[model samples]
Each structure stands twice: as C-alpha cells, then as structure tokens.
Target: MARFVLVSDTTLSRNYRSVPLLDFLASAPTDALPNAIYSFLKGPPPPAAEGRAALAPYAVRKLEASLLKHYSKDEVVVAHEDHISEFIDEDTEVIGVSTMDPLGLGPLTMSYAVFFETRAHAYVQREFESLLARINKARSGKKAKLLVGGPGVWELTVRPEELDRNKIDFAFQGEADDIAGDLFRYVSDDSGEKTEFFRGYQTFNANFRKEWEPNPKFISRYQFSKQFPALEEIPDIVNPSVKGMVEVMRGCGIGCDFCEVTLRPLRYYSPERVRREIEVNVRSGQSNAWLHTDEVFAYQHGRHYVPNEEALLDLLRAVMSTPGITRTNPTHGRISIPAAYPDLMKKMSSIMGAGRNNWIGLQVGIETGSDRLASTHMPNKTLPLKVGPDGSWSDIVWRGTYVMNKHYWRPAFTVQVGQAGETPEDNWDTVALINRMSNSSLDNGLPFEFTVTPMQNVPLGLLKSRDFDSVKLDQSQLAVYYASYRHLAKMAARDATSASSDTNVAARYVTGALVGVGGWVMFQQVKSICRKGGLDLEKAARHGLSERPQVPSIAVIR
Candidate 1:
C-alpha cells in the first residue's frame, strides 16, 4: 500500500485552457487563445496532466527515482480528488494536498467568480472542506497525517482555527519546491526541524520573521537545485494547461506586493534546460506552453537586472526551435518589457510566427496609476524605468500597450483596490489610467482589460497585518472597480473565445454588466456568504446584496 497520497485542488486537474462556464463567464477567453479555433469552442478542456491517471505515474517515478527515499514509486498514489475516499484508507499514512486557494483568497475567486456562482467563495471552501472530510472519513480515525501546502496556505495560516478544526499537520507557505524532499522525510522518518517559513498546525501564535517583511521566508534559495519535471511526471487528466507549463526562471519575478511570491532575486534556467522540458511536453502529445516567469524580458540579465537582448532572444529561439511549441503564453510581465526592447519584442513576436495575430494574451501587473503608490508598494514593477526621457507611468503604459499590440500580443492588466496608503488622489488617478487604457484599447476593437482585486492582507504579504475589513473602497476606487469589470467583460467577447469550448461570449458581456453594477456591495456579500460557508449566492444577494441587479434584467440590456 502507498504511504502517501498527493493531490492538488480542482484547478490543476483540468486543461490549462479549459475555463469552464462559471470561470469563463467571469473573464476573458479561457486562457485567451491566440489561435482562432481552439480559444473556446474546442469542447471541454482535456484533463490537465496533474489528473489522477496522468500524474500518478509521474509521482511514482519522482518518488521511486529520487525525490522520496522512504517510499517506493508503488507506495505513492495520485487519487482522483473526487474519489479521494476510495484511495485514502488505512494504508495511507500521509495525505498531501496541493491547492492554489483553500480559503478563497485568490482574486479570481473573489472578484470574478463571486457574481454568477453566487456565494462562490463559500462554495469553493465547502468543496475543499468536503474533500478534507473525505480523507478523515476514509482514514477512520487512524493516524494519517494531513499536510497542506500551496500558494493559498496563507488563508489557513492566517486563521489558525481553520487548521485546528481541519486537523492539518503541517502547512508550508511560499514555494514548496526546495522543501519537497524534506517534507517527504518528515512523513517517512518523522524527524526534521520545523521548516523556516513552514509552521506546524498550532503555531498560529508564532510570529512571522518580522513585521515589515511579512513573508520573508518566501525568498528564493540560490543554492536549491531547481528540478525539471519529466513531461511524463506532471500529467493533466482533464485538459492540458495549454501546451505545457515550463518555468523559464524566477526572481524579482514581478514583485507585486499582493503576490504570494514576491521580492525574490532573479534566476533563469539555462536555455538547454528549457528546451529539454519543452521537448518532453512535445513527446507527450502536447505542444506550446505557458512559460512561468516573473518577467519574460528579464531572462538572462547581466547586472542590475537590465534586459539582455541576446539572452532573451536566444531563450525565445530555443523555445521556438523545440520540435512543437506553436503558441507561447507567459504567466506575467511588466509593462516595461516592450518599453525596454521594442525592436526585440517585435522580433520575438515574429520568431513565434505571431505575424499579425495580437491574440497572445498575457497577465501584466499595473497595480495602480499613482506614482507615489507605485514607488511605495512595488518600486520595481514599472518597466523601462521612470528616469530621464523614458516617459511617465501613463506614457509607459500607453506606449507599451501600443508597442505590444502592434507586435500582436494582447496584454490583460491586473489592478488592485486596497493598496497600502492609497489616497483619494490615488483612486482618481487609477480611474484616469483605466479610462486612458480603455480609450486606447484592450485589443484592436476592444478596450483595456483588467481585474480589480480587493487587497486582502494575508499573512505572507508585506501588508499581512493590514485588515481586509479596514481597507474600505471610496467612491473613486469603487468607480475603478466597476469600470474594470465592464471593460474586461467586453474584452472577453472580443478576446476570441469560442462557443465550442466555453460559454458564449455574448453571455459574458451580460454577466459583466450585472457585476459591473454590483460594485463592492456584491463583493461584500461574497465575503459574508463565505464567512458563513454557504454556496447560495442568490440567497446571499437577496438578503445581503439586495442592491445587486438581477442577471435577467441585465440580459435584457445585452
């Protein structure tokens, strides 16, 4: 019998491109496909490589090969999460859950999914708790330690009560890669010091390393050897994460104050390593990839983190030459990439044969427009540097947007509401920037697209002590929030998602309008309902969010 059962939440189990009806209706096209055909209407996303079938074999290999010396490959089982009860019985000594959001703190979970799914956060929480309950029920009171780790571990660590109630043994925050082997040993030999950033279940009383550096343990370990998973190892059962996922590098990777992984030093994998990972995915019948990086252009930097054109272009060329990577989707980039290397940006676009197609959508962080806020929360976020004649934030945003669009890359921005020390002037500035980008364009005929997430002061972020309840939204900030939802919905229709694989784009606009008018009132209901752990948003909306317009009425406007 296997000694451990490892599984991620529902998000990682599906195809990366697979944005289901609920998830799709809330945002731009699923994964924003550059190719016209597969963007949507392709049908349900094929299962992700992390699915029970696809990933179990990989876990076995990783465990037996080297990652785990305490157990054989045969001792590791990747059970279908929904059928967790069937596999997590007496024989299972440890249950390791990998989730992105256990308490529904993610912006996607809070800002977007809250409207249609109604009480969405609570629903997601129930689903997660139910899964945990399944393990407990199957274990039948036997001592199978429950280990939880992921980007969302903060949601639990922030509230120790949840960990105790759920009986979680260990919770590891930040990147879990470096400590995976050590974690395995903790289960196998039951010996090891408590990890630096990681805490035992009841250590809620223990303070973070320091106050200003809320999540200091999140920093990267320069000495840790980065492991590249064999394409065979991290399989997706439902659908692929569009091509495959390959981490090109990590460091100062965006440095967004609200991000779980921030303030990290820059590091890049050798081009040879990147190429091999891509080849592995190609061999596994998957082409293309969602390149994981803090900044694409920051690849192979020389000194002081300046863009190295040769290194950046060489990495792109290596990825392109990889037998089958047609579409290249990056996780996040600063508005400065196109600013610093306009010529190389166009060249890189051409190398990928994105001749004139600007549909290559990327997640860019433009958290706020106020220079003061930018300098305070995330000084390094602004691309091209604000010195000399480089242009102002507005200029960089507009110029970068124009440059990137010209090269066929559709960039979707991320704007936050509860930034540290945001003033009335800052809110107005944010709205003005949103308006400016809206007028400029989200795509050819589309307006700018951005998701406005309320800044929750989770334990791992710089503002960990900042309370979400205290971060109230003023009228100007509320206006920014409303506008962001409407524009993004419209961008979805124009984002080229098809009916073949996702919800009709027309419905997207309708839902957007409902949420567009819902404002913070709707968001509060989402939180309130979540605290109550209920899934019926309609009931919550009616009783708590009475001001929210009915979806049917919004449909008429559409």
Candidate 2:
C-alpha cells in the first residue's frame, strides 16, 4: 500500500530497560541455569515493580519525519515495533530496517564472549532474524526488497549468506540522506535490481582482506547541515532508553584512525536550534538527555580542532537554562577539550549539577598509552600536541584524567587491547598506564573514577583488516585485559552494595563475589608475571621453553 515501510530493530525499538533474571537468561538456553545463578549473584533484574522502559529511537524518529516531509500522505507510513504486522502486507514494496549492530559485534560481542561469558544479547541476533521473518511474511510472490543500514551494517556483510538468504538487496552504509530519493525511485521501478552494498561502497575490493570492508562516504558540512525533527513529528514513545537525546552536532574533524566519525565533515546546530529541540523534548516529557555527537567537546571547533570556549559555554547555557532539562550528558568526546580548557569542564559540570549529584557518564576514547603508537595511529586524538615532542601520551592522558577527577566527572574510558602494528613494548606500556591510574590516589581516594572499556577492533574503521577474534595478546596484554574486567567487577560489587535506586543487592553481591575472586586470581597471576619482569615474548622465544616452567598462555575467545 506504500512506497517503503521504514522500521527500527528490536535493540533500537525497545527502551533499554534492564533485563529481568529470566529475560537475561533467555538469550542462552544452554547456559540459562548458570546465567540465572550469575544474575542472582551479580545483579538481578529489578522486580516487576519497575515499570516498562519506553522511549523513541532517535534515528528512526528523525528519518520517519524527514521521509514524511519528502513523501505524500499515502506514499509513506511509519510503523512501530508492535504494529509491524500491519505494514508488511502484500502491497508493501520496500522495507528499510535501521540497526546499530545486527550481528554480535562491537559492545554486545564483548558483553557475552568476554565480559559475562553467558551469551548475552542472543536476543538481539534472534530479533534481527525475527525482523527478517516479518519482512518475508507478506512475500507471497510479491518480492518486496529488503534494505538494511546503520553503524554496524558492515558486520552483516562478513557473513555473505545472511544478505543472500535474507533477500537483503542493498545496505546503505554511512549517511544515506543524499541517496534517499534514488532508493525510492529504484524500489518503484520493477526492472531495477539493487546491489548488496551501497553504490559508493560497491567498488570496495574486499578480495584480499581477511574481512569484508565497506568504504563509507561521509556527507560534508557544506552539503548536509543537520535539520532537527519537529516536535509533532515524534510519535508516541513505546519504548524509551534515555530522555532528551538531541543531536548537538555531527562528525569529528580530528579524524581518529579507529573511529567512524572522522570519515565525515564537522557540522553543528545553532544555539537557538539546540534550545528549540530542548524545549520540544521538555514538552514531550523527557527531562534528561544525552546529546548525540561524534565529539561533543569539539562542537564549533575550527579547522585545527581548536576549542571555541565562549560558543561552547553559550550552547551549554542554552541547553541547561531550558525549562525542564535536569541532566545533560555527552554521547562521546575527546579528552583535549577538558584537559586544554579545565575551566570549561568545571563550568559545564557546575551547570549540569553544581551542588547535588555531579556524576556524569561520558564516553572518552583513550585508545592506547604508548606515545609512538598514539602518534602513528591516532595523532589528532589529542589536539595541538604531536606525540613524544609536545607532550608524552602518558602525561597528556594523566593530565586529562586528573582534570576529569577534579571536576567530579566519571567517564567511561575506552581502551583498546590489541591494534595492528603494535609492539610488545606498546602493549606493556598500555598496561603500565592502566596500573598507574589504578594506583593513583589523591585526597584520601582515587581522584578519577571511571569504568574501563576494553575495546577490540571492528571492521568499521581503518583497522578493518581482521575480525575482533583475530587479535592476539601477550601475557602483559592479558593482564591488562583481566585488569579492566577486575576493575569493573569491583565497581559492580560497589554498585550492588551502594544505595542507588536500581541496585540489586542479591544479584550484585553474588556477581561481585564471583568477579572479585576472578579478579584476585588474575591479579596473583599478573603479580607472578611482574615478578618475572612481565612478558618478554621475544626473549622467551629466543630462549628454549626447556628453561622456564610456565609458558604463558594466550586466550583465543572467538
């Protein structure tokens, strides 16, 4: 009945409500018993007393409105997750599904295989397959085309049969705004057949690489300025994750090698535009929100990643001064904004929460600690400083951490384990940095408190040569890997005992004990490695194994 039916995946549709004990275990039936026990010990789902989580997916919401403006009334219809059946009838011509990661890649991959080891997010994969089934249900010889796109669209291409079996005709990777009209036209034409990848990415030759690489074409600021969705455009919130998710800006001009943001050009909304969006959110009943940006601190940055402190302050004032904005958090950002301009950090933190709870969850990319590695891999990550000469990577990192701690900001630190062309010294140097942060204590406690994220390489960025599993780590790297888990495990323990509203005492207590013990065991092994002066793989390989009793083991968790 329509030109194209647009929908979001289950991961995006449902508000990210915390899973119940049984719900969490439903992901892995084989390990359900253990997962249940684990949930009971670590963190149990809140009793049904907590109501259903609800919110709209920002992408789908924006796209639905954008496409709505472009198309006539009967030509387009936006469907919610629950009402998916109504739109997938015989008359449906095209289905556009948006997802962050349809496959078990990125954070979800690490969650089950590495962190929990309990097959978490199995529901995500199943939901993806379920979406395919829904799309296929009305295909009584109708042959409606299926198109998928999003942050993790490339992950699906790795498994070619998924595209073929699912009848996925095209995947519009990166920003597809420019080609939306073309897609609609192609779908309308009965004779036209689409390729598996986007037109721009079709030329990417993945013949020689170990993985399928899709070259994404970024929309420059000159061509694509972001247009915020109008208030009335937002449909009812069926499932909600976080309130007030506004797009303050797009693209990180810094061009970090590992991130997808660098591939695009930098552009932002005016303060008035930002305020208008905030007022819309307040009217819609979302008091708190995490502003979506590749790099929030880098908003209004000039050609060389320079900070426009006054402009930033004005923008923050506009956001914070809005009638009902209780909390404002950044989706992701670089460290230089706070490190270079400490005053801004203090002012921003004060505006968000000056007197009461000042804790804010921020995503910061502190990929590696090795100076040479930082220089070679992500030179522009820290502004105005070339690695080794201007300031050592460690110093820059330490200073940033100190500044964050001083301002009472708790950041979620993303640290990569194994990267291409990294030496053993580079690995050890990273471990040493983590150790220093763990050991640092000021004013009777740790100046900086953060959850360490052990990031693995994905096919999305410059290092798309191999899958995450292909990464090999030496003993020192293993120590660092376990260290992150251990640190987080301890934090989980504290959360279990803490007086937070969502804290599950029984589950967190059990999880804390398990993680604490596991971390302690890892610590003991690491201590022995430290006694032996860490992993000297080259020296050990050069010397026969006949001399050393313990030949260090590498974990292959594929």
Candidate 3:
C-alpha cells in the first residue's frame, strides 16, 4: 500500500467525449439531467494500470508531483477513483483528493440551480459525496487522514460543517506547490504547530477582498506571500493530465472587482518550461495542447495591461513546434485584447494552423454587456481599449468576436446575472448583445463561431443556507437565459458534427446527433420557462437584429 494516495473527483477524471465545452455538462443539476445521458456524455474514466490513473486532472497531478519530490515513486500513488481501495491500507498515511466546485455552489453550478428552480445537488456535489463515501469505506479501520484541497476547497470553507459531515480531516486552501512535502508531513503526523501554516481559511468579501476566519477543519499558508509559489518553486507534472492540460501562467492581473483570481500575484512560465510540460502529455499520446491560464493575454503583459504580443507568439510557436503537438489553445482571455490587436490575432492564428475545421476554443468572461456594469465591476478588463473612446463594451465584444472568427478562434463567453447593483435594463442589454452576436456572420458567410453561458452571482449567505429557490430569476433574467440558449441551440446544430473529437466514425456521428438534438430540446424547455415567466420571446428574437453591424471585407481563410 502506498503511504500517500491522491485522486480527483470523478467529474474531473473523464474526457467528456473530447467535445469542446462538453465538460460543463457535469455542472448540470442531478434532477435536471438523466443519468443514462450524463454517463454517456461524460465518457469513460481514464485508463488505469495496476490501480493508477494514466491521466489525471492537472491539479491532482501537480499535487502528486509535489509529493514525489520527497516521497519515493513506490510510496506515493495517484489512484483511479474506481481502484482507490486497492491503494488504501493500514500503511496509507494520507488520502488527498483534488476537486473543483465540489459543493456545486460555484457560479456556473448555481446558475443552473437558480434557473431550474430546484435545490437538488448538482452532479459535481453528488459525485464528490459518493467518492468521499468510497474513501471513508476504504480507510474504515486504517490510520490514514483524509485531506481535501484544490480550488473547490473554498466551498468547504463556506460551509465548514461539511468537513465533519464528509469526515474530512483538513480542507487546505491556497497554492501548495512549494510546501507540499511539509503539508503532507504535517497532516500525516497530526502536527499542532502553527509556525509556517495557519489553522483557518481565507474568505473574500463583496469587493473581492480577502479575510481570514478561525476554523480547525481548514489549513492554509500563514503569510500571503506564501500562498502563491514562484515560478522556480513550482514543479512540472511528471504524468499526463486530462485534456492535455498544462499551465502557462498563474494569475490574471486585470483586477476585476468581481473576481478572486486577480488576488494572486502573476507568474508566467517560460516558453521552454511550457514545451517541456507539453512533451510529457505528448509522450502519453496526446497531440493537442490545452494551455491553462486565468488570462492568456496577460502573459508577460506591459504596463496598463497591454498585451505582450511577442511573448504570446513565442509561447504559441513553442507549443506548436513540440514533437507531437498538432493543435493548441489557451483556456481564458479578455475580449478587448483581440479587438484592439487584430493583426496579432491573425499572426497567432497562422502559427497555430487555425482554420474552419480546426477552430480554437477559449473561455472568456464577458460578464455583462452594459457599460455601466462593465466600468464598475471590471474596468481593467478593457485596459488597452477604453469603453467610450474605442467603443461600447458590446461593440468591443462584437469586433473581438469578428476578429476571432476571422482567425478561426471560437471564444466561449460567460455572462453573469444578479451581479451587484444589477438592474432589469442591464439584463435586457445582455439579451440584446446575445441576439446581435447570434445573428451576425463572418466575411466567409460562416456564422460567428462562439458560445455564451449565463452564470449567477449567488450570495454567500444564500449558498450556505441552500436557499437557492429564494433567489428567483425575474422576467428580464429569464430573457437573458432564453436568448443565450437560443444562440447555443443554433451553434450546436451547426458545429456539433464538426467539433467532435471521437476517432470512431459511427460513435462521432451518434454523439454529434445527440448533442444537436439535445440542444434543441433544452432550448424548447427554456422557451417554455420564459413564456411562463412573462418574457416576450418574439421580441427577444428580434431584440438587436435591427442594429447588426455590416461585415467588413477581410481576407480570412475558411
């Protein structure tokens, strides 16, 4: 038996059929989606060899690598969820699980709960509970300590009692790349010394400010400087990660008031470091590189949040030049960068070999379309391009989408509802933006290739009480949801067949068909909900079509 066993929640272990953005399906409420379909869509778990997962989530892989620096390969095991029992025995000193959105109170998960009007646990929460049950069962008579950590650990801090309910010994917060060995030893030995660590977790306020509260179930770095590991301190993954993921950067410097990612200091990985990590994934038969970052454009950025085009280009070139990398794309970025630097986007697209058949997908947080909200919540998001001087927030987004589609980049946008000081008109603005973008096309007559997902800003108090039904979506909010779903349904019907990554022809076709039909059916439900909520679907259908911008002539490869 291994001394330290690490695993990730089931949702993060699968490939989601390798379809872009399909991973979001795991956030759907258990009561809303059927089990048969969910299981099919999530695909099979990663292959295991002697109870060890061949590919694990990137976060768990990082933790595993950190432990390996001190522990021998035989002493540490990254176990598959199904075979965790095989690794746990009396000698096992600690069982570490990495999770994202374990409690399902995350913005996207809560969005579904509020929209669906159900308090049922999301698939994430359900799978986490089930995994905990399995772990507890495996370690029933053993002396192993259950340690849960990762980005989702914050949810546990919000509901600290869950630590006891789940039989978790400690929920660690913040980055532990530099101190993983110390942390493991502390947990394994049940240390009471608070010299390098604290006995509490950190919380963020409405303004995204950090606060600490005393809690024995939680452990975190004592000093803020210790929360983020410097570039030299962080170690590379020794194994392949799910989706061929490799971290390119650590924090987003945009400083969006509503975001906590901005709190961490920025750290960029050199192009050489990035390529080394990609090589590890390639050795495991992954040809596509998924660069993980809070903001891709912020890599080695200049003053005033200006994008360093040369740095970004070098990074892309390095990724593509890797031995087995056939494609590459960043995880997240801001729209204003693409809007203000079209030439840079075109150059990067050429380097990545992007085209109609090879669309590059990115997740962007265009939280709101209203300029008032944009200026108030995330003024720095539009750094290089001022809202009034360059264009309205919607206009900037429109031009950015146009440029991206022209260069074969499809950004997945997330908009938020119920933000601080949000008004009905703000939601209507969002609906109008979605309608206009959905109706616009590229120079090659291809529809704008992108997706818009609506997220809810659930208050902490409500999240703790599980009183989601009390937070109802008004008519305008329902309109935003309707408009977003309408556009998503159209995109699904058009791109599902082409975007699927399954190698088997028959399986790919079936998966595409299911995805397309599922989108239409989901949109129908949204339409019914909107009709019952007193939203004017017809009016929403034509909300911003009258103001659709004319497509400018541009040489773009289809």
**Candidate lDDT (C-alpha), each:** 0.53, 0.57, 0.89
Is 1 or 3 the stronger prediction by TM-score? 3
| Residue pairs with backbone atoms closer than 3 Å in model 3 (clashes) | none
- Residue-level lDDT of model 2, residues 1-558, one tens digit each, is 676777767655432222211122223322322444433432322122112213446675555545555676466655665555566666677777887766556542543343333334455565677777876675546756777777767665555456767667666655545445455555445353443223333223333222223333211111122322233333322222334677787677787665556656666777777777667667767777668887887888766677777778888888888988887777787765666667878888887774325466678878877887888778888775445554667667766666677787766777776666777677666666665565554455653466675655434442243343444445656555655654655554444333132334554444445544534554454345433545553432222123322211211111
Better of 2 and 3 by lDDT: 3
lDDT of 1 by residue, 1-558 (tens): 667777665444444233322332222222222223222322233343333444322222223233344456557666666666656666677787766567665665444332323332333455467678777777767767787765567666556467778766666544434355655656544454444323232122332222222332222222233322333333222212233667677665545555535445555687777777667667667766667776776777655556787887788888888877776766667776676657877777877777444356666777776767877776666644652245556556666676677777766676766555777677666666655565554336544433433322223342244234443444555555545544444444444233112234554444343333333344454445443543333332222112321111000000
Off by over 4 Å in 1: 16-51, 55-71, 107-123, 174-179, 188-243, 253-260, 355-358, 387-389, 441-471, 496-558
Global local distance difference test of model 1: 0.53
Could you tell me the TM-score of candidate 3? Answer: 0.97
RMSD of each: 10.3, 8.9, 2.2
Q: After superposition, how far is residue 93 of candidate 2 from its true place, in Å?
A: 2.4
Candidates ranked, most accurate by lDDT first: 3, 2, 1
Top model number, TM-score:
3
Using lDDT as the measure, which candidate wins? 3
Candidate 1 has its poorest 10 consecutive residues by lDDT at 549-558
Q: How well does candidate 1 score on lDDT at residue 460?
A: 35
